[model samples]
Target: MVITYIAGPISGNIDINKQAFLNAADQLQSSGRVVLHSASLPVGLTEPQYMDICFAMIRACNEMVMLPGWRQSTGATAEYYYAKKIGVVVRDFNQTLKVSR
Candidate 1:
């Protein structure tokens, strides 16, 4: 089974950001992939601390699914580049789901 990390904004409009992550996680799981969702991480940590946690999770995943608005998120953008640097497949959430379906 493939392990996929869900990456997106978590700072602005947190509710919407979390919902987007959950929706993508559900979709990916339904497609038989294991999902590592950052939104599931505990809140209140400093940005650097959160990124540290997220980077560790990303390193464990086989792929990354970047949600809409990811471009606007510093963390998500960093994840994207890190995934690329480490050779983890990076995919658009909508495009990946459509292809899987």
Candidate 2:
């Protein structure tokens, strides 16, 4: 099974954004992929610290699932590039699902 980390805009719009992340995770899990994501956004943490966590998860995973609107997020874009730099496969979650179907 492919291990995947979820990356997307998550700084604001907590309810909506978290749901999108969860949905992406569910979709990937159903497709037989192991998914890693920050399911809980801690109450107080520096951006760099949070990014470190994200990067660590990405490193542990073999692939990354970029949720919709990933381009709008600086963090998501960083994650995408980092994955590329580390040779981790990156997939647009929705697009990947469409092609799989």
Candidate 3:
């Protein structure tokens, strides 16, 4: 299966928007891909613990499908940059549709 990390904005009003992103992720997961979803993480974690899990999640995935607000969050943007630095296939939601079609 293609391991996919689903990245999205996860700060501030994350509690409000994350559910929508997870819905998208659920559809992606139906394809039999392993999806690394932030929703899977426990809430209210320390900064370092969160970062550690995020990094580990990124390392385990083959690619990333970053959601619309990814760039709006510092941590999500950093995750994108780190994924690129590590040579992981990183596709924004816009880019994904271009190829998926």
Candidate 4:
């Protein structure tokens, strides 16, 4: 399975953006596509634990999807750059066409 790590903005009062990513993950999952999302991170997790969780997710995934508004997030931007540097298949969610469709 090719796990796609979904990276995007998670800060500020952006519940709608957060939900959008979750909805995207749901849609992908419904089609049997493997997708990882940061929203799965527990609220108020310790810094080290958060880093561990994110690293684990990135290591487990074969590729990454920069969710819409990812550019607005500092962490997401850094992850995008890292993914590119490491040769992970990074793509923009808005530009991708669903193969399962």
Higher-scoring candidate on lDDT, 2 or 4 = 2
lDDT of 2 by residue, 1-101 (tens): 78989999987787899999988888888888888987566758888988999899999999888888889999999999999999998988877798656
Ten contiguous residues minimizing lDDT sum, candidate 2 = 38-47
Best by lDDT: 1
lDDT: worst 10-residue window of model 3: 92-101
lDDT of 1 by residue, 1-101 (tens): 79999999988899988988898898899999999977998888998999899999999999999999999999999999999999999999889978998
TM-scores for every candidate against the unseen true structure: 0.97, 0.91, 0.87, 0.84
lDDT of 2 at 22: 88
Evaluated at residue 38, the lDDT of candidate 1 is 79
Off by over 4 Å in 2: none
Please write out the lDDT profile of model 4 over residues 29-62, one tens digit for every residue. 7766698877877688775576567767887788
Candidate 3 Cα errors over 4 Å, as ranges: 97-101
Clashing pairs in 1: none
Shift of residue 35 alpha carbon in model 3, Å: 0.5
The lDDT of each candidate is: 0.91, 0.87, 0.81, 0.77
- The predicted structure with the larger lDDT, 1 or 4, is 1
Arrange candidates, best lDDT first.
1, 2, 3, 4
Q: Model 1 residue 9 lDDT?
A: 92
